[model samples]
Structure formats: C-alpha cells, structure tokens
Target: MSTTSNPYRGFRYPAEIINQAVWLYHYFSLSLREVELILAARGIVVSYETIREWSLRFGRTYANSLKRRRPRPGDKWFLDEVFVRIRGKLHYLWRAVDQQGNVLDVLVQSRRNKTAAKRFFRKLLKGLYYVPRVIVTDKLGSYRAAKREILPGIEHRQSRYLNNRCEVSHQPTRRRECHMRRFKSVRQAQQFLATHTRIHNHFQLRRHRLTASEHRAARDHAFVAWRDATGTALIG
Candidate 1:
C-alpha cells in the first residue's frame, strides 16, 4: 500500500485503495463494483458500494482540480453533440474541443434548440479567456445563431469535415456510457461527462508528428499540470 498521506483521512480504505479505484475507473472503464473486485483479488477488502461513492464524490472533485491547473485550451475550436440514453430516452451532449484534440467543455441538455445551444456556449466560454479564431460545427442552425449572439466576430464554419475533431472526441464518453447502461437522469450524465472531459484533457498527448520522446515529455508535462492543479496523482 502507498505510504502517502491519506487525503480522505479516517476513511477505512487507504490512499492506495482509493488510487486503485480511481485508476480502474479511468483506465479500464470499470464500474465501481469492478474496481472493488479488482482490488479484492489483491487482498484489499473494500466494498463495491463504497467505491461507487468514492468515484462520484471524488471523481468530479479531482477532475475539476486538474482542470484549474491545465493550460488554456487552444483557440481553434471544434464543437458537436452526441446522444446519451437517460431513463431509456435520448439526451444530447454538447462538446467543445480545441484544434489539438484537447477537450474544452461538455454540456448536457434535454433539448437541442437555440436556448440549449446558448447554454452550452455559455459553459464553453466560462473559463476561456481568448476567443477561438475558428469555431467549427455541423450544419446546425442553433449553433449558427449562438455564434452570432455570443461570439459575433468569431469565424464560424459549418463544413462537413471540420467538426470531425469533436465528433471523434465523444468516443471515450460513448465507451464509458456503454458500461453504466446509460444514465438514469440528465443531471447524472452531465456530471459524468464534465468530469470525463477534464480527465481526458489532462492525459491527452497531441501525438501527431511528434517523436516518442517528445510525446512522453508532452504527456509528462500535462500530468505535472494536472498534479499541480488537482493535487492528485495521474493514476492513468
């Protein structure tokens, strides 16, 4: 077990157990019970239910911590939405990513109308300082209107391939969604995606055209930022 100071002091599980639980959650797309079982075989006698609590309570907290210290996302933005099942119905996830595949923001909504689009844009512009030079989206009228209302001077491109960057960005979320059988509430889906976005941005290496060493260095640098921001180990 790790000898590090326990962040959740007096909790039955040690830092090692919590670390392992979080690791499994991020790396293996493991559910809380799966994390408990994985650790149980290794002789850590924690419960699946507690693991779930740890993840929900701490996961969002940790992810937010990492985001605070992460570098500002690049200015070339790609935006899109994906459908998530909530209570056997469809909910939309609005996602924003930078040119280098860094996730910027994620918003969940019951509708995809102009108001929904505006809300998503508000979240995206919250922490960002400089405006993106290019905002890429599909042929969505709401996005076009939101662009005009919020970021008037920003160049909005409604091209086919331009949004491939963000469309592909949802793959990890989709993978995780498959595990939970889908969210029961829109709020739950929103919360999970928000955390996942920060986690993804923390670890994503802009692996395009870089040498192995450069990629490693970039990843290491990102982790350092994550640690400084969140005060948690980059367990993945």
Candidate 2:
C-alpha cells in the first residue's frame, strides 16, 4: 500500500473489491469488462466501469506490491526494444534484462532517439550499485550515443547476433499483447508493462538450463520467495 492518503476512503466499494479488481485486470491481462465478467462468473457482481475505476485508482498500488516483492536485478544485463502501437501510432518499448533474462526496467516512448534513449538508460542505471560489463544492444544509433555518454568505459559492443538473446526475450510481451488487443495509451502500456515485467521475473526460473530435479527445486524456492513476499500463495 502507498504511504499516501486513501482516495477511496469516501468511496462505496470495499477495499478488497478494489484490490481484487486491480488483481484480475492486471494478472489475467483482462479488460475491465473482462474482469467484471470473470468475477460475476464467480458470483461477485460488479460493473465493468467500476472495475475500470478500480484499476486506474489501484494499478500503482498493485505494482508497488509486486515491486516490494521482487528480487533485485542481477548483474550482466542485455538491452533491447520492441515495436508497439499505442493509440493507432507507432512507439518503441525499451527494456533491460539481467543475465538470467529477468527484465529490470521498461520504458515506452514515442521515439528511440537520443533523448528517449538517455531516459531509458537512466531508468536502468538508477538504483544499481555496480556497472554491468558486456552491455549488449542492437545497431540502434541512439543506444550507441547514450551508452557512450552515460556508461563511458565498460565493454559496450554492437554485435549483430549478440543481441538475439534479448530479442528472443520479448516473446512473452508479444504473447500477452495478443490478449490485450494492443495497449490504448502510452501510460497504460508503461503501467501494465512495468507490473508485468516484475511479475514475469518473479516466476522465471532457469528451467531449461537446469536438470529436471534441479529445475523443480529452483521453481519451488522461487515460489516460496513469492509467497513470503506477497503474504499469499500458500506453499503447501
């Protein structure tokens, strides 16, 4: 919960109604109406508009909850971008991922120019105690400029195939976009992507890299951390 005062204090719905609304709308990639329909199916009647209001009011709260739960970003980062359409126009999503491919931060902006690129770089660089060597990125000129400016020294390379690792990591975002029918606005895209990235990092285990039993153990441990962090998701 935010340290800010509650705007919903004067509202009619109960707190759980708001929380559940945000949860369903976010966790399932559901539209406000879809969340209402899903809950109605479970005998909880609520209007889609109500769900929308809840989502707008509580989306940050939900994101904050997951942020507090998420593990710190790992070292050795890869960077990439994906094309997205926001309000019938083109936009780019800049993302940073750790060596394990856990998304560290996400930014949605109108252009991938130096200014936008600098903003994205700052977002990733903030809160980091150490610098990552071997920064991987595409042939984008903006990345070249920004990397040279902000991260002067470490080994920044522009290999063609080197960034394929980050490119492949965009698969989940693409998969989820099909369900969302595309994001309506930049704000919505940023909010949803930020929360989604954190959630994805929480569940992503190096299953393919580990043996079956080892993978299972890693997954179980990740789930335990998730449960403890959220104070939900019973381990038994």
Counted clashes in each candidate structure: 0, 0
**What is the C-alpha lDDT profile of model 2 across 1-236, one tens digit per residue?**
43344445687866655655665665555667788888889788889987777766666655666666666767677888889998789999988887778777788999999998889888877746567876888888998899889888868878778888688777778877888789989988988788766656566676778999998998888756644443333212
TM-score of each: 0.88, 0.77
RMSD of 2: 4.1
Compared with the true structure, the alpha-carbon lDDT of candidate 1 equals: 0.78
After superposition, the stretches of candidate 2 with alpha carbons farther than 4 Å from their true spots are 2-21, 206-236
RMSD per prediction, one decimal? 3.7, 4.1
- Indicate the worst ten consecutive residues by lDDT in candidate 2: 227-236
Poorest lDDT segment (10 consecutive residues) of candidate 1: 227-236
Superposed Cα deviation of residue 87, candidate 2 (Å)? 2.4
lDDT of 1 by residue, 160-218 (tens): 78789999988888888988888878888878778766776577676877899999998
* Candidate 1 Cα outliers beyond 4 Å, as residue runs: 1-7, 222-236
